[model samples]
Target: MNKDVRASVKVGGQGQWSDHEKWLIEQGQQRIKTLMPEVYKTICRYAEKDSNVWRIVRLGLVGRPDQFWACEAGHVAGAPFTQFKRAVEVSRLIARFGCAHVCMIAGHGDLGGT
Candidate 1:
């Protein structure tokens, strides 16, 4: 998906930052505040103060248009569970087998792929 919207600026680590780091953090916070509310809202919905995990999956350390994923902490209980690919497979399976097979398919988890 398009990461033109992001929660990176608000990626935890606040209050304990140094002056210079705080400035940068504020800039990121500003970016989120001033530039992208849709992204920010998504972040708010998926991210939490002490729960949830938000990781930016980029090609390298930094750049643009990276993939951002949200893990429902309660769902996996601390394990990061991304349904990006799994969701796709479920879609395909349901197309063929119908919704009744969802439990059967989901029970297989990664569908033998990782």
Candidate 2:
């Protein structure tokens, strides 16, 4: 885990995406499928099946979770990404699984800090 963070982060740099990043992306996909099925469906609807945004979502790019956050919070005034990044759900997910786990699930991993 440390190796992933140390070797692949933008500052030090692997100059390429890491295996761990790929795995976290996969885990995020599974989590969405299992835990946020409705959001998953909405993603399929809005982002559309197999579209570029959907593809990004699969890679853990923090895509549609933003929309979910907006809906749940009823705080639709700001950018969806802002809602997502600051939401309670995301905070907990990061605390539990590390930032890489959620970074791009719908959006960049933010140089990937915990």
Candidate 3:
């Protein structure tokens, strides 16, 4: 399993997707599947066939982890690449895995921190 899928598995809710969100996730998933065949394979290796794991991964990037952000006591993992760096890493991971586009969308601040 890839880090994003693992991170996403940690979240909750049955991902009621809006049309736009669904479209984006599917687009990312398709791109990843085509561009980074290895990453997709990794995801397949890790995720449950019945679960919307890719959706969770996308949500993790676009939004915050529901569990972590839900509770006032919870916190984001203070990694050096939490935001943009992670996004870049994700992009690289996708490309390294032969993915065309990154699954995660990041902001400028997401790139600058750490």
lDDT of each: 0.34, 0.39, 0.39
Worst 10 residues of 3 by lDDT: 67-76
Candidate 1: 10-residue stretch with minimal lDDT: 70-79
lDDT per residue for candidate 1 within 33-63, as digits (tens), equals: 4555454454454344412223332111122
Select the stronger candidate by lDDT from 2 and 3. Answer: 2
lDDT of 2 by residue, 1-114 (tens): 122332333213326545665555555556556665555555565464334444444323323233222222111211234434345666666558653222222332332212
Tens digits of per-residue lDDT, candidate 3, 12-106, equal 65545565645545555555555565545544543555245444446643444320011011212111234333546654664476533222222
**Better-scoring candidate (TM-score), 1 or 2:** 2
Off by over 4 Å in 1: 1-15, 48-114
- Sorting all predicted structures by lDDT, with the top scorer first, yields 2, 3, 1
The runs of at least 3 residues in candidate 2 whose Cα sits more than 4 Å from the true structure, single-residue gaps closed, are: 1-16, 59-80, 83-114
What lDDT is reached at residue 37 by model 2? 55
Best by lDDT: 2
Q: What's the lDDT of the predicted structure labeled candidate 1?
A: 0.34
